[model samples]
Target: MATYEEVKDIPNHPEKYLVDVRNASELKETGVLPSSINIPLPDLERALNMPDDLFTKAYGRDKPAIDAVLIFSCKAGGRAARAANLASTLGFVNAKAYKGSWTEWEEKQSQNI
Candidate 1:
């Protein structure tokens, strides 16, 4: 699993992609993580498989390379885990799920704990 600190350091690591598997509506309800790009779980596979230009246009970021670091996060942790697994199966050598996800992130950010 990806740690909260690792996810938080995304800005310093352009090579890593912080992917939020939550749907658009969820992101609207709960603020998205900084530097994260939403690819809703359902569209993840297609997005990953699509051409680089298409992926870039759709996500405003280049699609991650086969061996790039893919950190997945969701409302809690379930979907994130699934996302990481899917990415790994599709040849992403460094895919990982943030077990704490948004819940832990929100808690930590809110209380500054």
Candidate 2:
């Protein structure tokens, strides 16, 4: 899995995908990445099983392509790692977890809020 710092250096590419696995409340408590797919982990199962048309309806038609780099993040590393593993098993080629997550992000930035 790539560290947030490492990914930060990657040039902005529309092909890269950032998936935030945090729930709505957690996202509210800790801000999300500027451009990220906000798909809570608990809802992963249904989304995975969604029919092609339904998938577009639920996850949006712009859901990142499977070939794109899938970076998953949560409050801590635990959930993000699990989500990454699941994505890998499901055929996401470049699935990765942001091990530091939001806690580390806030700490590294020294953001009080």
Candidate 3:
């Protein structure tokens, strides 16, 4: 798993896949990471397996490879960790949770601003 500080560098790397596991309502209330995609936890697996063209059409990005460095985040760490575990079980080799998740991200962003 990665810490919030570690995740801060992810946006600079185009090959990484950062995913937000929060519900749409939560995302609507709180902004998301600039490079992250929203694939609510419930739809994660299906979204990951979508055809390349379909996935791109839906998410505006190509689907991540099974061995891609995938980082999952949520409001806190719970759901993110769960999503990471699920991704691993589904054969995603490098899925990891953002240890401090969205809460930490928000805190850090506020500090920067």
The model with the greatest lDDT is 1
Model 3 steric clash pairs: none
Candidate 2 residues lying further than 4 Å off, grouped into runs, are: 7-11, 49-53, 111-113
Winner by TM-score: 1
Query: What TM-score against the true fold does each predicted structure earn?
Result: 0.97, 0.80, 0.94
Error of 3 at 79 (Å): 0.9
- 3-108 in candidate 2: lDDT tens per residue? 8675554447557767788899988887877567778998865665567787678766455567778888888889889988888787778889999977787787
Computed on alpha carbons, the lDDT of every model, listed in order, comes to 0.95, 0.76, 0.90
Summarize candidate 3's per-residue lDDT along 1-113 as a digit string, tens digits. 88776688877888998899999999999988878999999999898878989999999988888899999999999999999999999899999999899899999899998
> What is the total number of backbone clashes in candidate 2?
0
Count of clashing residue pairs in every prediction: 0, 0, 0
The better-scoring model by TM-score among 1 and 2 is 1
How high a TM-score does candidate 1 get? 0.97
